[model samples]
Target chain A: MRFTSLSGLALGLALSSTAAFAGEIVLNSDQSDPAPKKAMEELIANFQAANPGITVKWNNFDHEGYKSAINNFLKANPPDVAAWYAGNRMAPQVKAGLFEDVTDVWEKNGLNDQLKSAAPSMTIDGKKWGVPYTYYQWGIYYRPDVFKANGVNVPKNWAELVAACAKLKAAGIAPFAIGSSQKWPTGGWFDYMDLRVNGYQFHMDLTGGKVAWTDPKVKAVFDKWAELVKPGYYIENAAALDWQDAIPQFASGKAAMYLMGNFAVAPMMKAGLKEDQLDFMQFPEITAGIPMAEDAPTDTFHIPSGAKNKDDAKKFLAFVASADAQTKLNATLGQLPVNSGSAKPDDKFLKAGFAMLSSAAGLAQFFDRDAPAEMASAGMDGFQEFMVHPDHQDAILARLEAVRAKAYK
Target chain B: MSAIAAQPDAPLAASWWKRNQLQLAPWLFLAPGIFAFAVYVMIPIVQSVSLSFYEWDGLTPDAKWVGFGNYTELWTDPDFWTSLRNNVAWLVMYLLAVPAGLAVALFLNQNVTGIRVYKSLFFFPFVISQVVVGLMFRWFYAPNFGLLSGVIKTLTGSNIAILADDRYATYGIIAAGLWPQIAYCMILYLTGLNNINSEQVEAARMDGARGWKLLWNIILPQLAPATFIAVVVTVIGALRSFDLVSIMTKGGPYGSTRVLSYYMYEKALSEYGFRMGYGAAIAVVLFLIMMVFITYFILQMLRQERDA
Candidate 1:
């Protein structure tokens, strides 16, 4: 009875607030972690200080809940600005006209030049829909001390990587630390392999379901992955562990490397590894002529079409796009700022990540973000299966092809 | 009441409301609860049945009439077959909880100094949320550091990651689910034993019945209601086995662990992007399968009611 009354009171308050907008800008974000939450609060503070007349209201949600909640929130009582992803992750929202076109804001703020690298990801139908704040590069985070102790060179090619894994195994260390229980960690391996083996366009096409999973190019990606999987280079029972659970293997020196996004650095450091103990390297070259395309999943802010405070939302977006804002935000996030003019973070991994991402021929959003959710789910499942049973390559690809056909339709 | 009773004895026409009040009062008392159930539960089931015949992503304004198209698609979808097979496996294996619970209840039914503590300790798993149970089992079956893996390694000279292996993943989860379910059934049986007719058992013993014979001839017949409830709950629990699979494997190792509930959720809500109509179709199929057992159980319940 008490719970019902309390919820009723909450509903009443929410309805009243939505009914009457008091020139306040409401921002909903999925930066519920301590660090990212703090960064968001600081960004709001800076934004409010810059525009004193504007009052900002921020509602933060946990990462997982936000994904399921966003659609409902957007359709119902959408905030003025909300945090979302880039690439195909954002494309559906753009198509439904649920996200506001922020091209004018981009043009007015000179973001075309400032956030040029992020333009292609943010644009839909030749118009920008959102401004990307931060993205982090994916690469191999390895224990240099272990590599040195094992007499393993930093692998630069497919053969070298294979040889390094063999040497690591010989030295009684696991070559890779992975946890596929969540199924997405396996997607990372597939993404990097596909990006290298077939380059960005073919990889993107495959994820988008434009290219069949049974195609030779797709098969080549799996064949390369099998080289590592068949050798038992990865830690055992990866499918039973989360990404965080796999970190102990690398931190305890049982495993030498982890191919992960830059977000993993802080966790690795927190696990008691010193800065000098660990280093980042690009996923090594596979196909000689194929250009290097990096996985740099981006986080961005956008205006919902149903927003009451359009002017303030535009102001917030413009303020967030500034070099000052992106620099402050990404510094706290420990990620690479999307703006070219933003001051680079001084951390070694961040410096390396920024360089790797900037030097890449193209940026493919990570597998889950790049593909439609249905295909991503099926693809990740196949990837995890392949990791466990690489010999089932043909059957897995055939299954994936069926899912792709259905999802695209 | 004194004034009304005195006045009601004076004229039949004036006392009609009082005469009918007993008959009307019960329905009046039940009206609110019945109305709530109809609105919240019955309406949604009807809505879902209708939704199964359409193609609509949850977010969309328009729903396209698909008329059994989703079911036709499911006919060819291998995941549907996998989920159905897993459901059958869950139902068959999960029934082990009944016998297992009976054994535990029999063991703990003795009057001892620390018997209450032992009973509570055995019942602890049911009190823990299934999410916690799932996590605990995930840790237990985790490859390197898990307790079970440690035992396996000691015995076999190699570690086995049960949840990671497609062949054993569903069974591992079902085992975890059974730990708590058995506890639940044991508590029910313990209560049933406490209420058993002591005189009948003594008479059975006097007639030379002993052990299993005593239990079968005397105690078991008296515990029919408890057994019925336990079987019903266990069957329901087995059919609705989603949380464990979701937490442990997420229907992974190539979607080998998916059951109807998890598949329906994945189709409608998760990163698969909302295929609400497709999800509804899956739910309808699950509901139909459940109806078979539900109908049989209800018929047996009706027979028992008639006899009573």
Candidate 2:
């Protein structure tokens, strides 16, 4: 018994000494999808190759499970680095002081200049809380073949879009294929309309709950939505289908256009649509002088406040921010690199997306990410309700205004 | 325990403890299970009750005391009322499972050829998980290409999206829930029917009791224990209807299918609101509802025990 006890004590000491000497960074990521998981693996391989002395232990979690798992782990036993979203999703963590400020890493590595587009989003109270590695642009993904068949030129303004929709309707095709059953697809529509009609500032204020849902500006945005909805531009019984379920309608030539993120390209291709057949376009100009803003939900990595290996964590963040690193990672991810100096993707769709996002006046992290979750849910519900029953717009707006008042307060 | 120590010098305390050992042994056997239940179940329930009186976002450590605030807010919340109404609908509609199960049991009780296989096949839905059951029902209720929609279109010349329509979504989900619940109730009655007092049934038939009269006067009273258990479990299942609703609609189509349990989950955990305090208040309300039934059940049992 004494010998066993003595050996246990010796083993514990040896383990402790090794732990104290060898630098280890624990990373928690929600990149369980095949493409992004491969990207993460390659990123860690390069990071380890660069820093031979440091070891990164990665804990991967499924997308839905990670949202709930994050709070428990961050408080009880936090990882050195964790993947999270930007904008209001990260705001709560920053406010709670759960995320470590990495402004110094950004300054020393010139990340502020390289990752310029995402810098404002990662900043909280003039300090950077995280390093964003990737983001994708949301736009109108349509069939060029369908446009040619209908004699519809790519819409350049609101009038052109309306005319194009009318032409498409005459040609026996709905203009948009949307599935608002899940409701986030409806959020994308609302985000774009608010961004186009009222510009980025109004979009931000409305999502931030600084503007009431009953505001006339908010009503005007809904009025534009009602025009398409009332005219039956979307698929019938759209609320019954999921986003993926709606993709089939667009791919089968039943629908002409889809307003979605760049990720839809893979599924669209898989559904037997050729790369040349499909095209990406910026949403048509709505208000002439407002410039253009887009939804670019950025994925980022941050050091938890309770992280043990701060130095190694900072090194990883710096590496993630580097243009070379981001370029390599985004190549595997099929997403745009957050770093501005990174090489533009060679894919035709991504090439178009990059150009559109690079020239955007601002980026609003999609409506759900910009607003608090409760308000976003209520707002999306209102949007869906408006879509199904546009006549009851006032009642829906009143309900939303009530929820916003309680949620924001 | 050890032959009562077998001597006078074994000490009086040992003898006394040993004398009372049979009485103590049953309690000693129950102690571990009782302790586990107290720790895991009772403690969390008490904690949740206390938590209802505070404002907690479920993440940060800084929880503010806000007595009765969450409850008062829930009183005016439309979502809360929607969930409550759906829960009532579920309770009323789910009772249909009991009578439906009885009908199926009666049909399948005969000793026909290959009856065992048919019975097993009918029991298949109950054997599978609720998640799979929900998915199967989702495909069945899918709007455009679903089997049910295809049938509706063929007959009525118009397809009805039951899961999408606000008026029918709850009923659609409840109907899915009934598939498995009816199978469960049928199995219970099947077992009860197997061990029935045959002599009493035979005597009742001889005394001019036939068909419906035979079933009402004879068989049902004998299956009282089975019926009681089925009602208890069905009531509990109705109240805790979360999985099917979650997998089917997620309280969507304007939150029309929201039930108390699903609403509580949304409030506490979902992307919508992590209002843990408010969720706990909702849970306390559900617990009170369950407690009403539980106390009634226990009181009934006690009264029966006295009569017996």
Residue-wise lDDT of candidate 1 within A1-409, one digit each (tens)? 9999999999999877754543799999898767788888899999988886678989989887798788889998999999999998887677777899999999999999999988988888999999999999899999999999999989999999999999999888999999878878888899899999999988888887889899998888888899999989999878878899999999999999999988888889899999889999999999998889999999999999999999989999999899999999989988888888989899898988877877898898888888987888888888988898999999999999888877875
User: lDDT of model 1 at residue A231?
Assistant: 88
* lDDT (tens digit, per residue) of candidate 1 on B122-199: 999999999999999988988878899999999999988898888999999999999999999999999999999999
Highest TM-score model number: 2
DockQ for each candidate? 0.52, 0.51
Docking class of 2: medium
C-alpha lDDT of residue B241 in model 1: 94
Q: Which ranges in model 2 have alpha carbons more than 4 Å from their true place?
A: A1-24, A53-55, B1-10, B13-27
Per-residue CA lDDT of candidate 2, range A1-409, in tens?
9999999999999988775556989999998877889999999999988977688899999976787678778888999999999988887678778999999999999988988878888998999999999999899999999999889999999889988999999889989998878888899999999999999989999999999889999899889888898998888788889888999999998899999988788778888899878999999888889989999999999999999989889999999999999999999888999998889899888888888887999999998889987888888888887888899899999999999887885
Give me the candidate number with maximum DockQ. Answer: 1
Give candidate 1 misplaced runs (Cα > 4 Å): A1-23, A53-55, B1-27
For candidate 2, lDDT tens digit of each residue in B259-303? 999989888878666689999999999999889888998898888
* C-alpha TM-score for every candidate: 0.92, 0.93
